[model samples]
Target: MVYDTVVIGLGPAGSTVLYHLAGRGFRVVGIDMARFPRYKSCGGCISVKVGELLDFDISHLIEHTVYGATFTYRCARMMDIISDEVVGYNIMRDRFDHHLLEQARKRGAEVVEGLRVVDVVEKKGYVEVECDEGRTFKGSFLVGADGASGITGRKVFGMDRRRSAVSVTAEVPYRSEDLGMEIDGRLFIDFGSVPYGYGWIFPKERYLSVGIAGDTLKVGGRIKDFFNTLVRGHTLLKGLRIGERVGWTVPTFYGEMPLPVKGRIALVGDTGHLVDPFLGEGIYYAIKTASMASSVIGDAIESGTPDLSTYGEMLKGEIYPEFTSAERLSDLVYNHPRLWYRMIEKEPEIMYRFYDVIRGKESFGVFYRWIWSKVRSKPWKVLRRWLESRFLPA
Candidate 1:
């Protein structure tokens, strides 16, 4: 049976796209290899922008809310940046993704789980997805959200697979008595901890998500070593027991992966290499870009035009520019840790702008430029920065 859209992968991007399309009264079917509430190796932090886009309140599902971050350099220098407002919520991907998938299903999208797509074929008027169960599904358009290494990307879109970054993650059980310090509900970002990469610790209710990500070609071979160094060198996690160490390849946008929309098939999330180059943040981009892809797709369906170049155009206008700036900043900041650390050492308030960047209050390029401008006129603001850092809790 042919449907309006056949979505491969039930993660945030694909599920959200299916939800939006089905809400518009389109016949959408979503398929995924994993069952509901399956494990996904992710930090599972969602920004406020993502919540607004989906019009879904994720606070109920949030395990913890962080108000600030402690940035450390190679386990030595540390800078604490605190804020009165909540930064982001720490969540579990298993629950978070299943929630979004269920929303799509409730909106009239048919969900098929526990089946893997073995092959994809683009025919005259519809696309065919052959599954492992010998079942074939057809749709006017196909969306591949099966992650960075999923077959839909290469088989359907003919995308060449390459390494962007390798993410190594571990979750440690948290006990109140085991914690030496009070859980002030702050996140942690460690720099200079890995070669061409960084480490993070996001607190959850009962566990802490700790991981590191680095450039695939440069540090992929040393990910294990980097992870080991991160855990060993971390000041707070010295005595805690860690578990469930897993590694996955994250695709970063570098122009090699083409714009996902073409013909009748479009890619979303990791399949399109939509993860941020600097921070390795994909959840926000996945939902954000999927919203755009779904809008243009609705237009395509209404006009009876199979051409999806509009979706590509919309991405170029809205999403690609931020990635360009992020890639540049990733090279500069991750490459020169000492320079960044020293700069923040002098002007600690600079980290506040980073909070704004993460919260979507400002763009990375704009924040970087703002910091550069402040650095150029350092003599004028030296007293102000000193007074603020000395008096403020951060």
Candidate 2:
């Protein structure tokens, strides 16, 4: 069968692209290895900006709305940063992805579930995708939104190397009556507690999603130990009962690599490494990138260009700057743990301001200038903290 565009992996990115293209009267086909409502190992938090981009009320799909967050560092300094507005939503990936895919199908997209794309080949005019079930599909344009280990990136783009981090997450069905709320969500990022990684506790309706992430290459068998420490040792969620324990890999590091776009092939979302390194959040970015790719590809098709050369340039211009800034911030945080600790300890208000920037409530320029002034004002204190952090082993 021939399609105007063949999108592999019907996750947020793929499904979003399909929704936009199909709604615009394009012949789109979306394929996924698994069926709808599949489980994905993710933090499942979406910023308020995502709701604006989707142009729909996601409040129904959201498990809970988080007004603010509590950030805890290794120096025993914790800050409860409250926001005037609802900053984010905690969602389950299974339900969220399925809902988006269904919306695409409702708009006339041909969705093929349980079809694993085993091989892809670019021909003279179109790209061919072969599934494990011996079905061959053809499309003028191809989009790869599979994930970190995307087949489209490896086979089509030839950029096979990916830097990844391991994360172990467990969602427990436990209620905290003492909290006096249906949901109390907090993001705990402990540096020295877990090497090169951080722990998190996100609350849902009647469940709590707890997890930890780090460089798996450095810590071999200690992943389980780290998870235990977060649940057992942490004061916030010490007595939570375990329900379903899930673990997965997140690609945290990305360099200035070329995108997976050739004559007729384009990559979106994780396939193109569009995730934010500092926050490990990709849902909003993936949806936005997929929307951009759909518009560009649809235009290329209608104009008879038949090529996707400009896709890379568009992505680099629109999305790469945010990812670059996030990478730099991630490096600074991971490199100087004690500076992060002291900053939270001395002036906890900065953490709330930082969270505002993160949730897009405030401009990055304002946040950066404030932090820069602090560093310039106390250079000696910052240097002393860095030196102190160097001696402390992870």
Candidate 3:
């Protein structure tokens, strides 16, 4: 059967796009390989901005309200920040993704679960997707939200895959009055405990999600070692019972794809490599970019303009700058891991300011000014330390 739009991967991005397009009275088909409510390895924190975009009552689904975050550096210096307002929500991906998929179905999108798209071919005016069950579907527009390793990105976009940081996360059920009533219910990020990355403890209603992510290419040992250390040695979490360990690789950067769109094809979410570098957050960008892609595609389909030029340009204009900036930052952070640790050591207040930038609560100029002030305050000391460390070697 011919569909107006076929969206592969019913995760956040796909679901958001399908929900918007179907609600507009378009014939949409949403496909996913996995069943609903499948567990995914993620931090599971959602910013308040995401709640507003989803238009769903996040309070109902959130396991906890994250007031802000705490940063602890290798030098044993720590700094905490309280949000001016509620910044985000913490949720389990299994429940969150399922809720989004159900929303798409309720909006009149045809959701097909447990069906994997085995092959895709572009024809004169449409794209053909063949599922593993020998069923075939055609659509004037195809969106790939299938994820980093999914076929849509690998086969169609010609994006060469490269691995960066890997994280092993475990959600353990715990109950302690001290732990349960955490001050400000903030996410605690521990640096220096792990090299090239940080460890996090995100609180939930009845459980705590603990994990560590580090640059796999630079770190000499296995990531499991870091996970083990966090669970076993961390003072704050020594008593928690072990539950389930989930691990996943995080892509730190995205080189230019050969084409984000071809005849009747467009890639969104992880398929387009939209994950953030510093925090390894993707859901916010995924949903936002997916909505943008849907608006452009929906307009093109209604106007009978199938070239998809406008959609490509729109993505370039809206999303590329942010990704470019993130790529530069990731390069610096990963290359000179000590620079981050030093900043925390010399000026711990900068860490809170950095968190503000990450949470979108403050402008980049604030971070830049803080960096400039620090450099000016002790130019020679900072320079000498960097040079001595580089030449002396560990």
Candidate 4:
């Protein structure tokens, strides 16, 4: 059967595309290898900006409403850098993903699960997707949301697999009274704890999502050590036994890479490397990119064309510039994490202002420039700290 749009992967990106396209009266269908409520490896923190983009309410799934974060430097010298306003919302990825797919289904989108897409090819005017078990799907346009290690990114778009972040995460179940409201509405962020990345402890109703992430090639075989240190050294995580863990790669944005659109296909979310470079933020970008991809798809469908040439242009103007700026910030923050942490500790206001960036009130470029201006004003001190960071033991 032919569909107006075939969405590959039923996670946030794919389900969002299915929801938008089907709501527009298009015949849309989403396919995924896993069944509903399947586990996903993510920090599971959705920024406040996400609410503005979605038409429906996700409050029912929210386990916590984060007002700020509790920052630490190598699991020591903890400081609370909070905001009077909301920063993000935390939800388990399984429940969050299941809820989104159900919403898409409610919008008249069909879903097919437990079949992995092995290959995709453009034929005549429609794109053909060949799945395991001899199943097949045809659609006028295809949206690939299959994630970082999926065939859509590697086989189809030829995204560079070498340039991404690796992470190890575990959700340790705990009672609400165990945290004593210390982690309530606040994230636990530890800097200078990993190579080119950081550690995070996101609070949910039932568990504490603990994880450590770093550049895949940079961290290499040492990712396990970093994860172990984070889970053990964290004061809040003390006495909690970590059990099963999952590791995955996050495809961050790279400037010189090719656009994620080819012929009748467009890639979204992790498959497109739309994740933030500095903060590893993805959920907001996933849904936003889906909204953009769906709009462009609608336009192409209305014009009786399946080509997605304009989707690349749309990303260039809207999302690419912000990612470029975030990449620049990432260079400073990740490369010299110790110094960056010290700067934040000395001037907590710097982090308070960054919360604005997280809140979407300030652009990344603006915040980056502000940091540079502060550094330039006191070059000698900043230079001394930089040199010490280079020489000091991590």
Candidate 5:
């Protein structure tokens, strides 16, 4: 039987697609390899801007409402930047993802769990997805949210399999009383602690989600060393014990980002490499892009033609430009972390303005140009410090 849409991977992107389409009174089926409430290796912090997009109440799942960050350099020379307004929400990925999946199910989407999709093919009028147990599902359109390394994205879409960032993560259990409320509402972000990525400590009710990510090709080999340095040097984690560490592939946007839609199949989230290059943030983009993909999909179903050109247009216009600007900033900051750190330390307003970007009030492209304008005026000052930081020993 053919449904209106077949969604592979019930993560945020997949669930968002399923939720929207099913709410439109279309028959949508979502399939995932894992059962609900499964563990996901991530920092799991949702920016405050996300709440604006979500129509439901996620207050129940929020473990912490973040206000600002404590920035450190190699776990030293700490600088605290606290904001008056809330910045983000922290939650565990398992419960958060399960909540999203259930939202889709309640909206009339059929869910298939613990079944791996072995193959996907687009035929004359529909797409066919074959599972491991010889069961086949057909749909008018296929939404590949299976993730960066998911079979649907790699095999079916023939997408580039190279991950942009390599990361190691662990949930270190701890009681809030031991650390006190000082840790509440503030995130710990450390720079110059790793090669190309930064170390992060996002507090939860009973654990600290700790991790670091860097450009995979550039620093992938030394990620373990970087992670070890972070865990060993961070003051807050001094005497705590760390559990089994897990490695995850973060497929950030890099070289030529092609349009994710083709014929009756369209890719969303990690499958399309829709992550931020600088921050390695995917949760926001996953849900944001999922909306764009689902809108055109809904229109195609109504028109009785799976014409997805509009989806491609939407991505190129709305999403791709932001990633491009972020890639430029990533190169500058990662290449000269010490200079960048010093600059931010001296001028806290720079970081404050960036908070506006995160809050959706300013665009990254605009912010990139704004920061460059500041640096261009004092070329000699920047040159002297940048050279000193580069050639001199830390």
Candidate 6:
């Protein structure tokens, strides 16, 4: 049977697209290579703003809610950034993704698991998805929600390739009663270990998720060593028993690459390169892009003509501008991190504003401009040098 929409990948983006499609009374089919409750390398931090996007409750998947963060630089100086309310929830991806897929299934979407999509072709106004299991499915439109390394957008639709960051994560099970700083509901971020990236410690229900990330090409052989040093350097996590170690590539949004919507095919989430450039976060962006894709595709299907040409326009109007601000801010913070550290040290309000952005109380676009405006009048010699260092090419 021909489906109204064919979704590739059953992660957050693909599954949400299927959910929305079925909710709109359309026939949708989702395909994925992995079964439900599969492992995905992620920090699994659920931002507070998630409630604004998804109407359902996910508290069952939450292990803990963190309201504060400790920022450590070179494992020496430290700063405590606190929020009035809960900042975000730490979760496990396997259960979280499985729940989302189950939601789609309950909404009348057919899920084809354990089947890899080998090829996708668009002909005669329909997209044909051929699976490695010697079968094919046809649909009105196809969405490539498969991840950064997935074959859909990169191979089938021919989207332009861009540089991606490499990250390594380990989940460690440790006794909560160990003598150390508070770990119940706090987030730890260390910036001294990796260049152009940071190390993070998020507390799950029964484990601590620790990881480090940096520019792939620049960090190359040093990533593993850096990750090892991050864990060893932290006194709280130094002696913990590691339960799992995994690595993955984050498709960071730099600028405009090839457009995601092409004729009868569209790409969502990592396949569309929607991950944030500054924070290396993709789950929220994945759901947002999936919502956009589903709305556009659902309308296209109902109109008896699937016009997906406006998908890029919607992204340009909504999501792409924020990415532009994030990229500039990333260049500033990553290139001259010591300068930023010093500035934040002097003015703690800067970090509060960042926390506000994470809480969805402020916009990154405005925050970046506010930072530039404050730095426009530089008095100190060190400040001038920092600006020159950032502006001048190395």
> What C-alpha lDDT, on a 0 to 100 scale, does residue 79 get in candidate 3?
64
- Superior by TM-score: candidate 2 or candidate 3: 2
Q: lDDT of each model, Cα atoms only?
A: 0.83, 0.77, 0.76, 0.90, 0.87, 0.84
Model 1's number of clashes is 0
> Which residues of candidate 5, in runs, are more than 4 Å off?
391-393
**What residue runs in model 6 are displaced by over 4 Å at the alpha carbon?**
159-162, 379-394
> What TM-score would you give candidate 6 relative to the actual structure?
0.95
Report the Cα lDDT for residue 191, model 6.
Answer: 74
- Write model 5 residue lDDT over 1-394, tens digit each, in one string: 8999999998999999999999999999999999998888899999888887688878999998888898888888888888888888899999999999999899889999999998999999999999988989999999999887688667765666565788999899997666633786789999887777788999999899999988777885889889988999888887789888999888888757566788999999998888988888899999998888999999999999769999888888888889999998887788778988989999988888887787778888999998888788899999898888777655
Model 2 alpha-carbon miss at residue 40, Å: 1.2
Q: Any idea what lDDT model 1 has?
A: 0.83
Error of 6 at 288 (Å): 0.6
Could you give candidate 3's per-residue lDDT for residues 20-104 as a string of tens digits?
A: 9998899999888999888778888887668657776656789888767776554235566655656678899989899988888
lDDT of 3: 0.76
Q: lDDT by residue for model 2 over 224-256, one digit each (tens)? A: 788877677666665557666676767553675
Model 1 stretches astray by more than 4 angstroms? 158-160, 372-394
How well does each candidate superpose onto the true structure, as a TM-score?
0.92, 0.91, 0.89, 0.97, 0.97, 0.95
Worst 10 residues of 4 by lDDT: 176-185
63-109 per-residue lDDT for model 1 (tens digits): 98777888888876767888887777889999899999988888999
**Which one wins by lDDT: 3 or 5?**
5
Candidate 5 global lDDT: 0.87
Root-mean-square deviation of every model: 4.7, 2.6, 3.0, 1.4, 1.4, 2.9
Residue 109 in model 4: shift from native, Å? Answer: 0.7
Alpha-carbon deviation at 77 in model 2, angstroms: 3.7
Clashes of 6: 0
Candidate 4 vs candidate 6: which has greater TM-score?
Answer: 4
Question: Is 1 or 5 the stronger prediction by TM-score?
Answer: 5
Q: Whose TM-score is higher: candidate 2's or candidate 4's?
A: 4
